[model samples]
Target: MSSKLRIWVTGASEGIGLGLLQHYQNLGWQTVGSSRRTQGPTVADYWIPADLSDSADQISAVNQLMTEVGWPDLVVLNAGVGHWATADESARSDAERVFALNYWAPVEITRLLAQRAEGRGLHVIVISSIAARFGQQKLATYSASKAAVALWAESVNEEWQGSAHRIQLILPGVVSTNIMRHSIGRDGQALGDRAGAHRGWSVERTVRAIERATRSGRFAHILASPGVRLALIMHDLCPSIFYLLLRRKP
Candidate 1:
């Protein structure tokens, strides 16, 4: 058996997943990165080129990983997709695609692995977002999807307590990534650029926060800065007033 700690990360082609994979690799851990992209620049000691959005792909990828790497010490179900559309506009399209990848797929994959594993210690880290706390204007489905994952992680954590199985949810605020590129604005154009989506926390900074939380064995980690957390707190405490004070658009 490999003496080094091994971790499997999904959605490792770009953004937070790529960042985390590289960080662990630098720390000398055996890292596996899974994504639809296979030919381009890749990190980690191993790569599983598969699209997690498809059930067959998810199954094939996990089975291949199991065959090649056996049981990983940690599994990061970071594969997700985001869209920016209002409820009215979203009705025009099939929302199930987003829901399937962002919510159901991760839950299914984790459940399958947990059920199959024969008493091997496992820690699952899932990427959620601060948007999950409540409904956001341009993030109706995105928010709901993340919220579903976070809630599931929490329930699973409780269910597996005092056992080797564990789940950790990392909820991030706005981070600089391509996710914002696909967002539709209130003006029917791209919304991310105007909202300063490209100016949020850096990939490295966000990864640092996640690592810190993992070391502390916390159940949840919100990757927003202190100021953002305060705003969320104010909104939670007085949502009506906050709603009146805040604007739906940038």
Candidate 2:
């Protein structure tokens, strides 16, 4: 048996997931990565191509990981889809797809891994969004899905009290990723060039925060700008004032 630390990261082809994959690889840990695309950036020791949103593909990917690399010491459920339509403009199918990948995928993966852990220790990191904190405009489905996963992790953390298994939730704000361009639009198409521009923490910084949180055994980590943190505080401490501020935003 190998004593090397093993890690599995979904959505590892690009963005934050890719950053995490490289981070673990540089640490000399055994790295396993999965993504919807068959061809990867050749960063991981093992790459399993699967669309995590689909139930069968999710199960198959997990089974393959367990069979090939065995249960990983750490699993990062970072695979998710984003939506960018107003609540009224959102399509039912697109909403379901968002939840399928962003919410249920991580939840199901957690369940499967726990069942396989069989009392062995396991740490799962769920990559939620800072948007999960409140109902923001034009991101109803995306926010809802993230909020669902965030709450689910919280509940599961309580259930695993005093147990060997642990779940960590990571709520990261906008990173320099193609997520906006890739977000689903009102017509169930990629927002593409129409998506609004955003700039925030780099993937390296976000990954560093995640690593710091993991080392400190924090239950939840929020990687966002100071302004975003202040907004969240205001939302929690003064709801009426928070909404008033939001309304005033142009």
Candidate 3:
């Protein structure tokens, strides 16, 4: 068996996933990455190409990892898609597609890993958006899916109280990524430039925060700007006022 520390990162083709994969690689650890696209630039010692949104693919990827690479010291369930649409503009199919990748994929993957761990200690980190903390205007479906997974992680952490396995959640507000350009829109198509530009934390900074959180033994870590943090505090402590402010036309 390989003695080097190992980490598995999903959606390693880009965004925070790619950043984490590279960071660990720089540390001389064994890195395994996966993406839906079989052909793409990636940084990983091993690359498993599987569309995790599909149930069968999810199993196949996990089996491949366990059979070939043994087990990783850390598993980052970061494969996710974004959706942008108003309630009226959202279609059922699009919503399902969003949830398939953003919610069910990670939940199912974590379940399989936990079962296969067989008393082995496993550290699972779930990357959920800060948007999951509360609802948003155009992010109805996306926010709901994220919230579902975040809550699921929270529940799992509690459920695994006495076990060697643990679940950590990363709630990042906004990181510079192509997620916006690739986000699904009302017509179930990439929003492209219509989604508008977003300026937030860089992928490197967000990854550093995640690294800190994983080491901090925290159940959930919120990576957001002070402005965003204040908003979340308001949402939690003063929902009435928070929603009242949200009602204002922007």
Best by TM-score: 2
Clashing residue pairs in candidate 2 (N, C-alpha, C atoms within 3 angstroms): none
Provide TM-scores for the models. Answer: 0.91, 0.97, 0.96
- Model 2 gets an lDDT of 0.90
lDDT of each: 0.82, 0.90, 0.90
Instruction: Tell me the tens digit of each residue's lDDT in model 1 across 221-245.
Output: 8888797788788889988766776
Worst 10 residues of 2 by lDDT: 37-46
Model 3 Cα lDDT, one tens digit per residue, 12-94: 99989999988888888889999987864556888889999999999999999999998989999998999989999999999
Off by over 4 Å in 3: 40-42, 246-250
Which candidate model has the greater TM-score, 2 or 3?
2
lDDT of 2 by residue, 120-174 (tens): 9989999999899988889989999999999999999999989988899999988
User: What TM-score quantifies how close candidate 2 is to the native fold?
Assistant: 0.97
Assess the local accuracy of residue 59 in candidate 2 as a C-alpha lDDT between 0 and 100: 90
The best-first sequence of candidates by TM-score reads 2, 3, 1
TM-score of model 1 relative to the true fold? Answer: 0.91
lDDT of 1 at 249: 40
